[model samples]
Each structure stands twice: as C-alpha cells, then as structure tokens.
Target: MSLANVFSIAGSGMSAQSIRLNATSSNIANAETVSSSIDETYRARYPVFAHAMNDAQEEGSLFEDQPKAVGAGVQVMGVVESQEALQARYDPNHPMANEEGYVYYPNVNVVEQMADMISASRSFQTNVDVLNTAKSMMQKVLTLGQ
Candidate 1:
C-alpha cells in the first residue's frame, strides 16, 4: 500500500483498539456493582469489530499504484452486552438485599475482565507501534527522495 494508505490503516486500527480498551475498562469498573434485581445489575459490555473495505483503492487503475492495495482499516461493528445471568448472593445484612435476603450482582467476572483489559491494552499498544513504524518508514522514504 502507499505511504498515505499506511497512515490511514494504522489510524483506523488505533481508533478501534481505543474503543475496545474503553469498553473493557468500563466493564471492569462496574464488575462489582450490586443491585436489588437482575434487571438493575450491569451487564458486561464488549466492543465488536469488522474489517472495513473501501472501493476507491481498487487495483488496476490507470496510474501506477502500490502492489498491495487496501483502502482502509478495521471498523467497529458495535458494543454488545453479554447475556450471562446475573450473580446472586445470599446476604441478609446487605443493604440492597431483596426480601429473601439475596442481592443481585453484575455478571462480570473480575478475572475475565482483567484479562480482557490486558488484551485490549496490548492490542492498542500494538496499533500505536504500527502507526509509529509506518510513520518512521514514510519519513525515511521522504528523505530518500530529498
């Protein structure tokens, strides 16, 4: 792909990873939240992603083009809520306990959320590194022409 396209691809990747990291952090922060009923409990949130394609960069154009051509980067599909069941705990002294002395907690698993957070953070960092590398390569190419 062209040097300009490299920047676009890496920029989209970084944006998608940022959304993923934000969702993971949000899920972790609300993992321990308690509620009186299942409906009131927070559900784990996850960001979905899909590959984005742009037709404008199709090959076989009249002008010379990069051997490898990709129009854009990934796109975030959406944030989805997990359908896991809410956690229930028996605690008579709990302030939010129901009539049966049971409190409902979010379905979030701390261990899983922490792992997801780490993964997302790492992915984001990787994207940043890709952007940096692409930038440096582009700079070097520019210097070669000078």
Candidate 2:
C-alpha cells in the first residue's frame, strides 16, 4: 500500500478504538443502574467493527486497470447489547424494586469494562504512533530529493 494509505488506515483504527472506548465507558456508567422490570434493565454494550475495502481496489476490478485490493480501514458494524442475564437483587425497600421485591441491575462487569477501556486506549495510542511514524518517513523521503 502507498504511504498515503497508511494514514487513512491508522486514522480508521483510531476512530474504531474511540468508539470502543465510548461503549466501554457507557457500560461502566450504567453498571449500577437499577430497573424494576427486566425489559427496562440496561445491558452491557460493545462496539462491533468490520474490515472495509475500497471499491476500486477489488482484484477483479469493476473499473478497468485498477490495482490490487487494498484495505481501506475499519468500520463500526454496530453496538451490541450483551445477552447475559441481569442481576436480580432482592431489595424490598428500594423504590425501584418490583412486586417480588427484586431489583434488576445491568450485567455490566466494571472490571472487564475498565480492562477494555485500557485496551482501547492503548490501541488508539498505537494508531497515533503509526500515523506519526508514517509522517516522519514521508518527510525523510521528501528530504532525499534535496
């Protein structure tokens, strides 16, 4: 791939990591929220990402004389809610408690969400590093002609 493509790829990666971080933060924030009904209970949310390829870069090009397939970047598929069972805590005196004196809490695991946040943060930093390195290399290449 060309040096220009490197920047686009790294930028996409950073965007994806940012989305992941947002989802992790949202899950963490709602971890302790309680609901009276199962339907109203918050579930852990996570971001899904998919590989994106440029249309013109297809092997059997739709357009004539096109180059080989090149990865464009990553795209966020969507946010997925965890299917894990919600916590049913018996709190008879709680305002949000159900008729059975049970309160529903989100399935979010704070520790896991924090770990995911750290991972996303590191991934974003790595992408930033990649962009910086690419920019430095490109600058050096320009100096070669001088």
Candidate 3:
C-alpha cells in the first residue's frame, strides 16, 4: 500500500480508539450511579469494531491496471451495552431505593474500565505515532532526489 493509504488506515484506527475511550469513560463515570429500577440504571457500553476493506478492490476489474485489493481501515460497528447482570444492593436509607429497600447499580467494573481506558489511550498514541512515522517517511522520500 502507498504512504497515502497509511494515513487513512491510521486515521480510522485513531477514530475507533477515541470511541473506545469515550465508552470506557462513560462506563467509569456511571459505575457507582444508583437507580431505583434496573431499566433506569446505566449499563456499561463497549464499542464494536470491524475491519474495513476497500469496496472497489473487492469488485473484479476488467483490466489489470486496477490496484490490488487492500484494507481500508478499522470501522466502528456500533456501541453496545453490556449484558452482564446489574448489581442489586439493599439500602433502605437510599433515596433511590425501591419498595423492597433495594437499589440497582450498574455492573460496570471500575478496575476493568480503568484497564480498558489505558489500552485505548495506548492504542490512540500508537496510531498517532504511525501517522507521524508515515509523514516522516514521505518527507524522506521527497528529499531522496537531492
């Protein structure tokens, strides 16, 4: 793939990682939130990602002049709420407690969310590094003629 394609790939990766970070932060923020009902409680969210391919490359061309099939980039499928069971606590004094003196809390694991945040941050930084390295390589290529 050309250096130009590297930019597109890295940019898409960065976007995906950004979404991941957002979801992790949101999950962490709502980790301790209490709700009276399960339906009202916030659920941990995770971003779904899939590999994207060049659509044009998938179609067979009549001539051989067409570029070979290449990966487009990472695609964010969507954000999905975790299906894990919510935490139920018995707290009669809580304002949000239900009639049974129970309060519903999200199943978000703060430790897990913290780890995910770090991973997303590192991935984002790696993508940025990829972009910078690609830019530097392109610049070096231009200077090769001198």
State candidate 1's TM-score: 0.86
Steric overlap count per candidate: 0, 0, 0
Model 1: residues with Cα > 4 Å off, grouped in runs: 56-71
The C-alpha lDDT values of all candidates are 0.83, 0.92, 0.93
lDDT of 2 by residue, 1-146 (tens): 67899999999999999999999999999999999999999999989999998755425746766556568999999999999999999999999999999999999999999999999999999999999999999999999999
Clashing pairs in 1: none
Off by over 4 Å in 3: 55-68
Residue 85's lDDT within candidate 2 is 95
| Residue-by-residue lDDT tens digits, candidate 3, 1-146 | 56799999999999999999999999999999999999999999999999998745344667767656568899999999999999999999999999999999999999999999999999999999999999999999999999
Local error of candidate 1 at residue 24 (angstroms): 1.1
* Model 3 global lDDT (CA atoms, 0 to 1): 0.93
| True-structure lDDT of candidate 1 | 0.83
For all predicted structures, in order, the TM-scores are 0.86, 0.90, 0.90
Mark the 10 consecutive residues where model 1 has the least summed lDDT.
Answer: 61-70
